[model samples]
Target: MLQRIQTVYMILSILVMGALYMWFPVVEDAAKNVVIDKSEPLVLGLILAPVVLTLISIFNFKKRQHQFVLNRLSIILNFVLLGVFVYRSLKVSGETLVSEKGIGVLLPIISIVFLVLANKAIKRDEDLVKSVDRLR
Candidate 1:
């Protein structure tokens, strides 16, 4: 099942998440080069949760409905991450707090795209299974 296309999509999602952790800057400031690393415990957890969920979904291929639910959950998590980025970009409390949006902010969007593709594939498989069941 790991050889499936959805698995590849999940792996790519994981890699993009890792790249965000390793080299990307989530937030920048006017004077500072980079403001926030993915290393913050909460940030790190949020960054990795989708990867974990996607992996779980990949391995649970025998349960297509469960896998579909997991993918939807992962998509919701990505949307939360995107919301956080947008929030950080909008409101500032102090001179040092001004948020400069970085290209790193786009990582969640990329992950979401892959997740959507994976979900689409999962839906196709589910449909095929249903159609086959009707044949017998």
Candidate 2:
């Protein structure tokens, strides 16, 4: 299954969520305080959701439908995370003094793209299976 393109996509998504976040700065405040990730509870949860879900989805090779479902969920969560990022960037507040934007802010979008590509591969595999079954 590791050889599968979808598996590769899911793995890349995991790296983005788990490893990349550790190194990249998400937002830099005007005071020179760099935030790699938001400390807010809900935001943290949303950030970790795809990491856990993608790991779970990767092992669900036998249950393609369930894997597909998990990817869909991950995609939705990423969208919500994106919205949060937007809100945080636009909000007029003291602590929300985001003077600089970083590449980390776009990680969720990149992850969503990976998830979508994985889902497409999954669907292709499912269709292939169905076609073969019909042949038999």
Candidate 3:
């Protein structure tokens, strides 16, 4: 169930990011003073991280060991990404508190929740594995 939720979250995140990129020029024009450069590596990082993590999650779905590591790593990565988002949000929010730019803040929060849930699911799987091992 949690894995499925995570998958859905990743799909949504990717779609949101793609939409932002597609409409970036218009968004920047509306903001007037601020310009969002989608070409930047940082923007690329934000877009690619979730994609890679999602693929990893899907590939390791049946492989317990890999799923454990991938889920844990995803949680850590989500936290790191959250930090980045918060920092950027703070910097941008300082200029304009109620702007389209503020929408970026929601992405990290959603991603973090999904990643944490994935980690919990992975931990549950690990416990089940240990219990089965003990049965032997």
Candidate 4:
């Protein structure tokens, strides 16, 4: 069912976000030795907070309105995170003249896409329930 899919997406997103947080210290240490700026870890945290919050919001899906609000907030936060990453990438690209590929880029993109799909599924579910109620 769509609800199950949404649940799975949320769980996966949560796991990914948590893993990044857990590994951040090690990553920061590694980055420090490199020529790149050390502020990447803070930027990563800013990008991840909404993802973690969105996963927490999934538990409240039984309350349709709340779920909708949470999903909207998640979407907004994801956009903000995306913007930050893009800006940072551009800034670094200008300075270094070479772009670095990292796990951070892919994870946020995947999480955002999944969150968007899950939000659509939630809306469809809500409409279906409303239609059924009208038929009663």
Candidate 5:
């Protein structure tokens, strides 16, 4: 499991998500104060669900199909998180709610990249195993 490249990618994805959750600010006000972050329940859940899923995928290494499915679900969740951030930043209700978008918004994209790479590696491993089994 740890020897697999996909495992490394999944670990990186987990780290990136952890950083986003702990340190990065989602949005800032005109005064540069953090306006949005994990303090919001929806945002918190969105940010955390992927991390949990990825961890589960990492552990379920023996079941390649299950791992792949989990990663796909994680990717979908990240997209939803990105959509929420975009919507929040774009929402205009007679005031500038999001004065500045922080680096946290991009974290999901990074995580998605890692997850995709991990999925690709997982697929390759699965293919290799299938090919070897055919030799029997």
Candidate 6:
């Protein structure tokens, strides 16, 4: 199972997320001041949650159903994280507080795409198993 396509997708998602955390800024001001980043507890937690879930999903690959569930949950969390980024960028005084929205904000979307592909692969595996079981 570790060699499955879903595993590759999950690993790529993890790398994207890690890159986002390590080097990207979510929002920065005109003075190069970071407005939101890993330093913010809430943002940090939100970013980490999906990575943790994906890791769990990778390790639980033997249980396709469980892995699929974990991916779904990770997707939801990523959506929530994206919402937070959007909200921060759209604040009424955003012009003053956040002069630039960083490319990091789009990292979650990339992660989500990878998770969706992983889920699709997992579902295909599940269906194949079910079909084989039906034959026996």
Estimate TM-scores for all models: 0.84, 0.84, 0.66, 0.70, 0.88, 0.88
Q: Supply the TM-score for candidate 6.
A: 0.88
Task: Count the clashes in each prediction.
Answer: 0, 0, 0, 0, 0, 0
10 residues in a row with least lDDT, candidate 4? 24-33
In angstroms, give how far residue 24 of model 3 lies from its true place. 6.9
lDDT of 4 by residue, 2-49 (tens): 356776777666676565455433222233433323246656666567
Alpha-carbon lDDT of model 1: 0.78
After superposition, candidate 5 runs with Cα above 4 Å error = 26-35, 92-100
Overall local distance difference test of candidate 6: 0.84
Which regions of candidate 4 are displaced past 4 Å?
Answer: 1-3, 22-45, 93-102
Among all candidates shown, the one with the greatest lDDT: 5
Q: Which sections of candidate 2 miss by over 4 Å?
A: 24-37, 93-100
The residue-by-residue lDDT of candidate 3 on 1-136, one tens digit each, is 3445545554564465455456543223325544445466776576567657666776666775676566566556556655665565555533552356555546655655655665666677678889999999
Residue lDDT tens for model 5, 9-110: 999999999988887655655555555667899999999999999999999999999999999999999999999887876653344444345566799999
Candidate 3: stretches off by over 4 Å = 1-35, 92-98
Q: After superposition on all CA atoms, how large is the RMSD of candidate 5?
A: 2.7
Against the true structure, candidate 1 reaches a TM-score of: 0.84
Total clashes in model 1, counting residue pairs 3 or more apart in sequence or in different chains: 0
Q: Rank the candidates by lDDT, best first.
A: 5, 6, 2, 1, 4, 3
Report the C-alpha displacement of residue 17, candidate 1, in angstroms: 1.1
lDDT (0 to 1) per candidate: 0.78, 0.81, 0.58, 0.62, 0.87, 0.84
What is the alpha-carbon lDDT for the whole of candidate 2? Answer: 0.81
lDDT of each residue in 11-114, candidate 1, tens digit only? 89888888777875545555664446577776787788988998898889899889889989988988888777667555533443333345567888998899
* TM-score for candidate 3: 0.66
Rank list by TM-score: 6, 5, 2, 1, 4, 3
Error of 5 at 32 (Å): 9.5
